[model samples]
Target: MFDWTRSCAYDEQQKRRFHTTARSRLKKLAAELALPPGSYDVRSNKAGVAVSGEVTLHHTAVYIQVGQFGMSSGHGILIRTCKGRKNYTGGANHFVALSMLDDIPALAAAVRAITGVGRADADSADRRAA
Candidate 1:
């Protein structure tokens, strides 16, 4: 429960709980992907008094919103990589919501595409081309 009426919006305890919930969801996907340690970090951003009402996955090129607290976000994950990334029909740069555990597989794929962690990098691509 986040208190938006307060100046800081949330307390240290609330912050820890929020982060834990977010990270646990992410870790479940990470375990599936076998991502190496420190492959990603869950950082916070300001959104009025709600500290991290919005979150970024270490990339500014894309945006994501993890739904929680029965807010409009719901219990889903939103990602903005839906130009042929998944079955999403959203416009380019628009976030597609995957709101259930059944969508985890799709979410996992979306996560990989957005983060570029499990995907081959420039060097690997170059080596393959050579």
Candidate 2:
């Protein structure tokens, strides 16, 4: 037999803990990236943690949203990107959380991919030569 009320309370507690840990990690990541001040925003609450920022990719501006919610291994990241459309262009679905310090490199790479930071420069140069 299981108690639904108790389960719900436990779930809420887990969410709170996850949100706190994720928010702390998000702030650390922002500082580690060292982007221009006020370039990106970090938001956290009982719900979850989110990092939204703008980056110029190949002469175009893009918005990137990354965050985490819940506390299951099933819990993962949500990355949403948009250019100028009402809907996102291409983004990730719920896969798995990658917030561990050991996973920072992968997280950073994902950020670069979405922002097209360093990679965009190389890509633009190749296109100009072609």
Candidate 3:
């Protein structure tokens, strides 16, 4: 005898909890990154929050979006970036889509590099060059 209804309820509850946790962590990370407060817009969706912000790196402006989703007791983050446009760019116009969770730190590092921060002591010259 299987209880499908009970299983679905449990799954939903777990998803809600995961979403909450993920949203909190994202806000914390944004603060740690020194990104201007309120510079990013966070909107709640069925899965999680949609975070959008403009990060300037290497003198180029980039539009960033992160869609977070909950799965079981864990969460997933979807990172996307778009080149700045003088006018509105339609959806799905991202220059990059980073789907792996493990790649998040690397992606963050890239952003930092672009923003002229987080360079190695030896690489200060490179940053200055940029």
Candidate 4:
């Protein structure tokens, strides 16, 4: 005999586990990037969990949100970014879904690309000043 109550309890437990896992992963990534402690906020959403924070990569300042939804292994990470108050009034400018748990490397690569451009611009400015 299948017990619906037991199934519900199991689902709740799994959701809690996913929330904790997602929160920890985001925190770890932020720490690795040297973001200020407590710069991000994690919360439970329709998705298993979600995290949002401001990240300045290169000279671009953007707000980012990552969310994980679903209980299946097929669940992936969703990233959304917004620049300036446009996030609130105009909405996000970018969105992507990464279908892997090990997306940290991809995230890091993006940051490097942005920062690399910033560095180039700074170098050009320095040369002009000299």
**lDDT (C-alpha) at residue 12 in model 4:** 58
Give the per-residue lDDT of model 4 (tens digit) for 81-130. 43433343223334434333246545544543433211223544598799
Stretches > 4 Å off in candidate 1: 1-18, 50-52, 59-94, 101-103, 112-130
Give the range where candidate 2 is weakest over 10 consecutive residues by summed lDDT. Answer: 51-60
- Return the candidate ranking by lDDT, descending: 1, 2, 4, 3
**TM value for model 2:** 0.47
TM per prediction: 0.42, 0.47, 0.41, 0.46
Can you write out model 2's per-residue Cα lDDT over 10-103, one digit (the tens) per residue? 3665445444555556565554444445555555434322211112111122333333323345234554444443444554432334433335
**How does residue 31 of candidate 2 score in lDDT?**
49
Candidate number achieving the greatest lDDT relative to the actual structure: 1
Better model by lDDT: candidate 3 vs candidate 4: 4
Whole-model alpha-carbon lDDT for candidate 3: 0.37
lDDT of 3 by residue, 20-98 (tens): 5435545544544455644554444443223211221211133343332233323234333433333234234223332
Model number with the top TM-score: 2
